[model samples]
Target: MAGTPTIFLHAELLPNIRQLTLHVSLPNSASEIDIRESTITLSESCRAVTVFTLHQDVELVETLKLPVKVTDASRRNLSFAGHRVDIGGTESKAQTAEYSFRLQVDPNDAGLTFTNKGFQEDDYVPWTASDMSTCAALHCKFCKQMIVDVASKPDTSSWQWKDLPSGNWAEMMDFWHCHKPDVHPDDKEGQKDIEAQNASVKGYGASNRVVATPRTGLVDVASFLVAESDCQNIKVLEQRPTSTSAKPASHDGKNARNIGCSGCSAIIGTEDSVAEGLRLYKNNIVVKHTGATEHVYETHSIDIITSSRFLDLIDHEGVRRFVIHAGQSNGILLWAFNPDLRYSSSSADHSIVSRRAMKVLYQNATDVERILEPENGVPTPLSLEELFLPENIYDELVLSLRRSNLLMPISARIFREWNVALLDRIEKRP
Candidate 1:
């Protein structure tokens, strides 16, 4: 629709209400095309839709077929209605026509049944909860260099893998210990002394401190925190102060450094000085399980890993807004519209039976330094979680967001400065 001479179809089935929302984008304006004669064929086995348009210069026909097979109970219950076709866009050069309709199931169909295989709770495994046996070996995805061999640890008898409670574990501890309700308001000096004494005795209120034990690997939503003595073939870059980070300091106090793969010099994670260990990103390393055969290793893409992190953030913090900063001038303002949804697109792969995804509204914040400042333009200070990512990972996230637009209808791809897209949820294997 956006100057391309191709058709795009997007379909979203709302199984809860037994309805399907459909959108079809055309290459020409509404005046130049006609769809009164178009046809849709629906059966228990498949769905086929055909569009025929006649213009003064040319005549075109296109068809979209969905490979979904339904039960016989739904064969006689589904229908399409409430059709709307019109032109969309602000400028003439970008204007295009789109057709939209809803396929509904009859309210009287009591015997109707739907397949819900991929939408189960267990399928949405968080990255922090991902399976990792004590015997597994961590390898760099880029160079295949072994970073940590769990079976070879000096204390194999005590070796274990444990997941952190949440991504904001340290922040929560700091808030609880520093802002205790029982502290007296009159004695400020006494409060400070009591807090310091409690911290020293219990060692439970240290901020930004993630210490990894000699025989345990601490797992968080994004990275694995492990002792430095157990790592190999990795390099830690010189620490430098971050210019655009709005979040808390890294493990290295006020400075942060990239942890790189020794073979390819590619960034795999960051150095955590507080933990005296390496925070290896999950997406950059492959995991060879204890009983893996044929040398197969489980690897996750950067986008999938990021999406899981978003879900984990939403779960723990109960917030959906995030500001991802790459540098001084560029960043992304992201809102998780719907944390989980079942979606299907005609332009996507037909082989897949079900797709679990998250709908997101993202905007490219050019003036990132002032985007959230109340004095600049924003009305008030926003409670946004901040992520300071390296340049390469930031680019990959932006690319993944933009590339997802191709799998959606043109009319629903954008809204003002915010671009609408979907980040797929990682499906766990049995």
Candidate 2:
């Protein structure tokens, strides 16, 4: 019994009841004090959750948002007005908790609503793949500007993200869960290397668990991924026992968790210190970020086009957009393939295409985040033509190459020599 409390309620009302309300009885007698805790304690992390979506047997265009009705016990209602999930350029006009989600169509007068209740309150989503992780781009630790603002350098101090083990995606996921750098349940595998490989597969770029954004995505899912250049962080949460665990458990029925002496609930934030491992946030999820040990800018072996393969598998509907290092391999990779580029083939010998990434581009992307692609944003591809074909292409190439961790310029002749040597490699490749 910790000083703080968490109670959950689920119920169904008959057609006759116009409204349903929930009331929770706490040990505290002061009303103002208790109310403040709800605001500070339960962050606005709770959004709408749904078991189903619009179009029962139709092609899916976008992931529909379904609002959730949350309240305490005693069946009292909450006064959270202005409720709706924004969809396809339109916001639901309803202020009710459980509203029917409908794609814009005439037959959908009934809109969207969930009556059967698919998941209970204390379901305990304990993995990076948990449903809540993809709530919105704001949830991703690396992508969201507020967490790791574009201007703020990458969490260089965060553990150097070791590339996940080489294995199938499923195996990588399993490995991530078992060998999470921090809290993790003791699986039957007993901390084996194979388990770590599996977790890395599923856990890569996942929101609940943080990793590097530039390399986020199931890259090796394609056979084209002959080798990996993956690098990012991992965390495993420690588990507590019914009565045998040494760490204090959470008072909220969810999971008996540890509590601070002053009584702030445990939350993982972006302060970059203890924030690296854990913190005490109410609703928001923080993916523990350890800086990468490897320099991602290192000139990678051109053995396999792993970057191009990643762009191919992006579920553009479920995603918002990508934040990549300017002129890095990812941009070059996307230009080489991405079907949406209006190009016929990746290897078609044509003009060099690339997205010129500015330091400000990433630094400015604090609020823009998406799991698939930015709903209102477009994928920015800094092309090579912008920096590599004109009057002073060499000068621009020098900077770009330097950024790519290629040859550094020592003198005019030295730069020309390095330039000739590099172009020679590309020209002879075919």
Evaluate model 1: give its lDDT. 0.67
Clashing pairs in model 1, backbone N/Cα/C closer than 3 A: none
Q: Whole-model Cα lDDT per candidate?
A: 0.67, 0.23
On a 0 to 100 scale, what is the lDDT of residue 428 in model 2?
A: 10
Candidate 1 has its poorest 10 consecutive residues by lDDT at: 111-120
Task: Give each model a TM-score.
Answer: 0.75, 0.17
User: lDDT, candidate 1, residue 273?
Assistant: 74
Q: Model 1, residue 228: displacement in angstroms?
A: 1.2
lDDT of 2 by residue, 170-196 (tens): 455656657858535675456566645
lDDT of 1 by residue, 224-311 (tens): 9888788889897654444552442365454557888899887888777767777888878888877787468888766678888788
Question: Which residue ranges in model 1 land beyond 4 Å of their true spot?
Answer: 1-7, 14-18, 26-37, 45-84, 87-97, 105-130, 153-155, 170-210, 238-249, 291-295, 348-350, 376-378
By TM-score, who's the top model here? 1
Q: Number of clashes in every candidate structure?
A: 0, 77
